[model samples]
Target: MAKQTIQLQLSGMSCAGCAKSIEKALGGVQGVTTVNVNFANEVAAVEGDKLNSEQLVKAVKDAGYDASVIDHQQPEDDSRERAQQIQFYKFLAAAILSLPLLYTMVGHFSWTENIYVPAWLMNPWVQMALATPVQFIIGWQFYRGSYTALRGGAANMDVLVALGTSAAYFYSVYLAASLGDHAAHQGLYFETSAVLITLILLGKWFEARAKGRSSAAIKQLLNLQPKQAVRERQNGETETVDVAKLQVGDIIHIKPGQQIPADSTVVSGSSAVDESMLTGESVPVDKHEGDDLTGATLNKNGFLKAKVRKLGRDSALAQIVKVVEQAQNSKAPIQRLADRVSAIFVPVVLLIAVVTFLVWAFWLDAGNYGKALEAFVAVLVIACPCALGLATPTSIMAGSGRAAQMGVLFKQSDVLEIAHTITTVVLDKTGTITEGKPKLTDLEIDLKGVNGVTEAQLKQAVKATEQQSEHPLAQAVVQGIEVEALEQINDFNAHEGRGVSAKVTLSEQSHILRIGNIRLMREHDIESDAWSKRKDELEQQGKTAMLISWDNQAVGIIAVADTVRDNANAAISKLQQRGLKVVMLTGDNQRTATAIAKQVGIEYVFAEVLPEHKADKVKELQQQGERVAMVGDGINDAPALATAEVGIAMGTGTDVALETADIALMRADLNSIHDALFVSKKTVRNIRQNLFWAFAYNTLGIPVAAAGLLAPWLAGGAMALSSVSVVLNALRLQRLSLNHRD
Candidate 1:
């Protein structure tokens, strides 16, 4: 049999349970090989041998959901639709029964008090008539869930409540029908059972809504990519193609103010691209020929003619979608514990409800059958594991959302949990601690037979020679040369790792302007005895020296180096204040790394290390029992990122680095690192507080309800209040501001 692949666009999943339901439903289909559904992207990738899309749709429909094929692809299961239907029916039934039940219990109508025709024709029987069907119809999920848990040899809060409340309502109905009117009126608890079910359902609905909002963030992120691109045909005309249909090497014309539809390399033209959506960089970046551009970022000014380098699943936008999707799907450590407990919770609660009923009915001296039924109801109401069921997911959702708002994207909730414990941070030097681009910072001029070379002449000579080279020092030389009327050079040649040499016509003599380091000056035999003294002074001041020699004579010296980020020192200081040791790791020479580290307040520096050595360094730190966080922004830094306790990738870094990182700082600023750590600490604290309230509410509320100090109706109300309190507390994490204050 030949293996085949199918794709479908799905909808209606609101939680992990819904994803599991859809997976199971599709798995049950005959001839289906495998099914993988990503709830975050609402897409399903399916594989099978000779499978029919119609059959998949039918299978999902049988499981109580709607599904449809995408472009004749396999149909996907939509559990949210089914869940909504069930919820709507539950709310409708509860609403219809609650009105009559409440009126009979509290209203002073003459009919409510009538006790004439038959023993069953009383208030208790009327209440039973209104509530019993509602329990079976609207509250059936709790009963079925409880039964499933019991059979699986486990007990949850649902099992206890379902058994307890169901018994109370059924027994009351029996008493109302069998006993005389007075006994039936006193014994029936139809109002208590119905009210409990109604309130619990309301709580569930609210919880579902909250979860829906939190999970929607990934979907919203996906919507940022445009659906179509204007592809330039070979005939020089443009045609719009679906983004999914775009292939590599396709030339795409991006007009001014339009979003780049795919990650591509600019083949022609120039523009300023706004990458704020991807890197959170505040300023727009100038993109010319040979510059790479990412999809979903705005083209701010000028037009760009780009050749698509990556499309479909390979694009940067797609990678981001995958990262966020996986993060949401990955289970937090606390959630795994909750799952373990829930697996056994239902059966234990059932056993407790049974034991409570027997002890009250047969063991106690003053116990009546009616009172025993009330005890059972109290046990079930108090034991419901709804709070436990919601604890981990709610907190994870709130915490991750809060992190995203602060421009920190955690690839997993466990990262947030682990980040708070980090004791040391390993920072990559270039691009992370300092701006990767080199700039000219110092200049010294000395000349023979001339007073001294003017700054304009030095700049003109450097720019004329350096404009043809792509080296960092050459670019710095070009930028430092501020003259606009400098003559363009011809026959420009760059010697790799040395310098740039070009010929410029000056005063009828062909002059060769050479701009490079000392190595390049030596190769040309240009004497630099006096220039060497000035170069040493600049190097001590944390600058790199470049010699400018014209026609075998040294004219000027230009110093260039990577500038440190303005906020690096402050960020490092803040991290130290928070009790974290700041360490710098780099491939640069020890002198350069130490100079940069010292300026940035970093006391620990590991220099001249290769890319492969970074992970070993992290392991060495861990061997000393330090919980370390590695911050880097290069493809070479990926190994250390995976090895560290938490890997923080700078937003301007490569895709490999971002994907390997545990947390991605969307803004490449160092201050965002401080903000991220602060948010993580607060988030963990908030989660603990929420968990405490959830546990405390049950610990205190259960006994009071079981001891009969609180009425069943009041217990139901209190349960709703408890769930609300947890949600509100989790929401408070979003309000924290990380702005620095004096």
Candidate 2:
């Protein structure tokens, strides 16, 4: 059976229990194999065979929530912004009405000395008149949410709020009627109920605003896509069209200082393109014919025409956006504890409140029903489950969002949380530590044979043979040779893992020319002592020397070396300084790998390891009790990347690497590896801080409220502060910096 994944936007999830309810509801649907609902980001991901999105939506609705299928082609809806606005207006109106009731209660305090209280304000009916609207009108959402959760056979933060405030409001009404004509405002607690709702609404408004800021990274990425493109018609005329209309093979024109409309290859013209938006490299890269151009990058100082290679969801920008959204929506393993506790937190709090009321009413203050009412209301108002539910997910959202802005993409929240514990980083030699592109760095020619073969003729012959090979080192040899004219070669053949040989018709005679490693020359029975010494010297200097032989005699040696990336040494030093063991894994021979490793300050080396054996090396590290992180160009390093505790892929790698790896570094710079770890540590630290406050707030507040020392109004204010403080603390991750100096 074929499987499909559907993502939906969710609404009305006030706590982790709501997320669990949606997950459970979707899990019960036919053809639904798996469901994950994230309360922090308000998203649900469902995977199943023969699944209907409508059925999933109906399931969520049946479970007392709202959901809609997300269309990635269109911009994300403004549901969150609208919700925030509505919350702000609710807070505003509640605050406006709450002020008069608050002032009336304050008028009874001796601290308001010399402030004359109006006789009408002191009337119990007047206090009830001001507080009634604040209780039912402005606070109606709590009652609605409470009813929803009750019908679903669950409870949430809303249930607690509604129960606590209604208890005080109704008890105060009973007292007012019992006193009849002598009714006084002194014993009435209407102010507590009214002020509590207003304060909770204020906290909700702040949380909504903070949540909006936490997702700003996705908004910025969505804005990068240009709305229109200049398409070149087949008739040699250009037309301005929507970017969505351009299909594969359609030619598009990009002028200087314009954004490339889509991911394409430059078919003509040369220019410098700024890829900072995609790769976070500030410098503009020079682009020539046949060079790949990414969408949303700016073309600087030249005009270019290109054929679209990818559009819509296939584009690099779209993929980044999708990856980020998934990361934000995913829940880390560390969050499981919080989720489990939150699922039972409200029920536990309600039971505790009941126990508190029973102890005060029947035992401690026997028959003193007013004191019992006060203890019950205070206990319910002070226990905030929302803080516990928001602790981990809010931090993950802010951390993942911030990481994306720095050109690092955490594909999963678990990876973001786990990266902090990686004790060993196994780095791939090519692409991870050094530039993957090899260039000819040195050339040594032997001319003492007196065979009438000049250095120029030998170089031309090597280039002719190397030109036919598709290997990077072979291309380097072809590029390094600068002969104005070359001889025509015939019968070219490539030997895998050894070299290439061809029969070149030079000087009107056929001569076999071979260019490859020493093993290839040895196989051909070509031997030269001088070339052997030169090859050793180049190899020791971290270069791969290809032996060039004419007929059966060694003629010259061409050395190719991959340049080390800038800041590789500094990045390695930083990792080592942090007490992480660094090792280099590569397919190159021991001598070359050791030389490159030495240059980059890496002590441990795993050389001559094939792509398939890379994972074995990682397993070997794990056996030694080390938590390993594998960093590589995600393509060839898939096995090792998958085996390690954390897999970090370079964004410059292939699609397979990006899809397989847990973390993607947009910049090729090795410094990003260190930065990723830095951010991970900071994010985890922030999560711990949020959890501590969440736990401490309830541990301290619940007892004080139950002991009858805390007033219901004060308890409500403390509860609101607890929820808002957790959100504020999580937002601190957005400002996390990896600004350590080298």
Candidate 3:
């Protein structure tokens, strides 16, 4: 079956159990293959064959939740803000109504006996009147949720809240009617029901507010795209239009401080564009004519008119948003364990409450119904599975979202979870540890002490041979030479892990030219004793040295040195400080690799590793019990990257590396590795904290409530506070600064 993925916006989920119920319901659908419901994000992703949107929505509704198909083609809506506002208003009204109930109940105590109070307000019937509206009207959501859960053969936080408040409310009504004339003076719980509901509502409002803040990163990303753009008309007139209206090949004018409306090539002007949003580099990059510009980056200075290359959803900003949203919605491995626990949590809690009530009523108290009823209500209210459900998803959402803001992208949830466990980080020296660009630092020519051929002629021959190869060193030699016309090279050959060779015809005379390392020279039987000394000198200086042999004789040496990145040493030192073993792996010779490693503070260096053997090296590290994270930027590194426990790709690297990597650092900055690890550790820690609170509350509070130490109303308040506390804790990840500045 050809499967398609669809994301559904969900509502009416009260706890982790609610998400589980929705998942089960959707999984039961005929065409559904897989379903993942993220309670924190309130979004469900489903993959299936010939899936019907209506059928999916019906299944969710049947499971007692509301679901709607999300149209990803449109800009994200602020419906969550509206939901938060409604929840806030409900809380405000509950708070106002609860005041009188508190005063009426507390005022009768000895601590406030001196305060004058109306006798009518003190009456049990009058108190019931004030609480009835609060319990039935303002708190209707709980009852509706509980009923839905019951109909779906499940239970959630709503079941707990509804059961607890109803017991108190109905128990008070029974007391008032049975006691008759003595009801005014007897103990009543009319205010208990009202106060509990109000407090819970207030906590929910706070939680909703905190959840909004957790997703603020996404909103900020969406806001980066300008709504309108000024398009330069063919007649020299400018027309303002929506960004969506601009198509490929359309010319748009960008001014200083204005966001580039579309991904385009600078065809006319030059300026500095701040790509910190995408690349995480704080420095603004200089742009000139013919340079590629990404959408949503700010034009810091000068004016530019460019032709749009990618528009609307195809733009880089839109793709980043989509990737981040998918990551947030995706489930991490830890979350799967939490979901497994939550699927059975509510039923177990219900059974516990039943057993607690039975023991108190029949065994302990021998029909002390009041004490038994209190324990039952307390047990039900204090047990909240919502906190457990929220532990991983919320933190993942916030962490991944914040990472995106910092220009690091975790393409999948597993990456964020796995990055924290990397024990060793193996860095590729060429593009990863040092700047990938290598210049032709030195070029020497030897005509065997037989003068007549100038150095310029030798350079032309080298450049012609280098042009046939795509290696970085070859490009450096080709660029460094000053040749107007290159003679045709026939029988060109490229040796894997060696270099290039070809037959050049200059002045109607043909000679074989081989440009490569010493190994290639030895295989060709070219004598290079003098050139070998020069190569060793260059290699000791951290420069790659290659020999050019012509017709079975060594001619000269070509050396190129790649500059180390500015933050290479600092990043490596930081990783080592964090207790991670850092190793440098490259194809450079031992001398050159050692020199570069020493400059970058790398303790371990593996040189002369061929492309195909890279994966084997990673395996060898794994055999030593090291959880290796391979960092590379070339297509040849793809196998090693896939073999490692974690693969980090530089954003400016090749597409193959990015596609294979688990983590993509948008810029060449090496510090992002430390930052990503830091964020991952923090996020995982936050999840653990949330889980502790969730599990701890139930583990401790259930027993205390069952022992009658906690009143049902107080248990209700604690339950609300427990869920709210977990959400607020997860929200802390949103403010986590990866820069680690004191």
Candidate 4:
């Protein structure tokens, strides 16, 4: 059975330990092949045979968390945002309630003896009353989460929290009940439990805010969709309607200063649309008849009546949002190490806490049970699995989201990891390096051998016959030479790799037209020696020359060329400067390929390659130990793209190219390639730094905490800050100097 990925939105996962339990629960389900729970983003992605969303959610519920299927079409769930608000209240309420107990605590310490403490405030009943709500009510989630984790045979950060705080709270209650009101000033630790929970909540609120900012890219993309559109009726009428009610194929009217309602093609009128939000290009693109108009692009001026091409989630904007969301939710390959440690994290901490309590009471500071209990609580409260869980995912989220805003969409997190490692960039010549649209540069006319036939007659015959072929070169000839269409075109035949032959009636006479290269002229038994030198001249100039035969006699030479993009030379130079070898792959002949290659500064060229053999060339490069990133934008480029280390596809490419590419560039230029590689290098480095810090905090803090060098409440503050620092480090990706203008 093939693996099917099922995505679920998760809640109630406090830290990395919670992720481990959810993974274990989901993996136990039948037919589940893999399960990854991203604690940072709160999404669980499971791959399996016949995976059921309801069943997966139930398993998570059984394991003591919440899960639901994620709906991409709808806006982001506001429940988590509401939860963040509630947590702020919890922290605020706990802090306000703990203030009295904290003041009473200052009375017990000799260093703060100068400070005044009221007898009523220091009463045992008053201290118990203040600490009770902070412990049981404000900190209720920790107990509930601990119960769930323990019932499911797992332990989480909540287990650590409940254990540490409960040890302090109940121990204080026992002392107060036995010692009566005298317990208030005699080593009571009610303030320890209340203040610890407040600090933990404070850390959670900050972490939630940082995680919220990390997903700003997705929210920005979703906000682009306009709510309303002006729909044109079939009776040549127009009315404003909700964009959701409009169907595909509906004609829409766009007014000046309004946004393009949805993805459509303009049928009439023209305008300058600012597509900076989608493609990251600051320039406003001009839209005329037959030009594609993407939804949410602002129309600066002019009126346009366009027919809708895609609606709802099928629109270009929606699809980009989906890609970004998926990228953010997916885990990076580097996170496996963190996951392995998280699986065993809480249990080991529990054992270490137990050892610290015994060793402190028996050996370190023998018979001092009160001091030993503090060491036990310190060890339990300080060990943070949350930082270990968030390290890689937070970096992946912020980095991938920022890249998407700059016109580079990383389809998966692993692709972001591997893209920076490409040593060679193999560029497909036609659409990748040069403009795919070909134009007629030269038309050599000669009717010397055939008398009574004007040059216009031969031109009409060639245009009418070429119009029947779908080849880019043939279409270029038809579009390049604008003329009235012929009424009759018959017996049109296309010869693969040679040219096209067709019989057309022109000037009240039926003529056999042969339009192709030297190979086609030979097959027709026509002599080609006359135009051999001219053909080489055109080919050397990076133009495709096709010879025309009129009634078996040589007529003229027609040359077509796809020009190199203006930024091609500069982009290639930058790629080489980044320590990548530049190679050009093309199906064009050797001389034409060489000429185009020289124009773009590419030293190595693979010319005269068939579409089927493109992947083979990529494999050959890989065999030579070169890690190649193939950049292409056609159906023929799919195989080679899939074979490369990373495949980059232009925005104007066919659907096949976009689907096969690892990174899809919204900007139809090579500069976006530089942007993609730059972001990749930056993102990978960010993940490494985050992982190192998260590991170091846990590794070094555990031993110090075990020695009782820190107090319980102080340890709780450090644990909370660890998760916050990791997320803050990841958000630095938003400050990238994309330099897309170059």
Model 3 / residue 575 / CA error / Å? 1.9
Question: For residues 289-407, what per-residue lDDT tens digits would candidate 4 score against the true structure?
Answer: 99998899899989999999988767788788777766777777888898888878889999999999999999999987778889999889889688888888888888888887787
TM-score of each: 0.73, 0.88, 0.90, 0.92
Query: Candidate 2 residues 311-425, lDDT tens each?
Result: 9888888888888887888888888888888878889999999999999999999987778888898888888677887888888889988887777889988888989899999
lDDT of 3 at 62: 86
Q: Which candidate model has the greater TM-score, 2 or 3?
A: 3
lDDT of 3 by residue, 391-484 (tens): 8888988999888877778877878888889899999998888888899999988886633345677677788888888877788888877775
Which RMSD does model 3 reach against the true structure?
3.4
Which model scores highest in TM-score? 4
Pitting candidate 1 against candidate 4, the one with the higher TM-score is: 4
lDDT of 1 by residue, 1-742 (tens): 7876555556543323344456677887777887755443345556688888888877666554456665311122446556656776687679778766654454333666663334333467567778887788777777765554344344445555576667768777777767746644465677778887887777666655555555555445566788789998889999999877888999999999899998899999998988866764557989999998988889988988999898766777666655554454455676656555545554565566677668778877355877666766776676565665556555666667666655677787788777888999999987788886888787766666543345566567677677777655667767876776357467888765466888876555567778776767889999878787787777677676778887778788888789899888888898889889889998654666678888999999997676778899999999999999999873669899999989998875226226688988877688777877777787778767766776677678666655556666666667766665666666666566655412
lDDT of each: 0.70, 0.83, 0.83, 0.86
Flag the better candidate by TM-score, 1 or 3: 3
Q: Which regions in candidate 3 have their CA more than 4 angstroms from the true location?
A: 1-4, 29-34, 47-55, 71-73, 93-100, 107-137, 176-184, 363-368, 445-470, 485-494, 501-514, 519-530, 549-556, 653-657, 738-742
Off by over 4 Å in 4: 1-6, 27-35, 46-52, 443-469, 481-530, 547-556, 653-657, 740-742
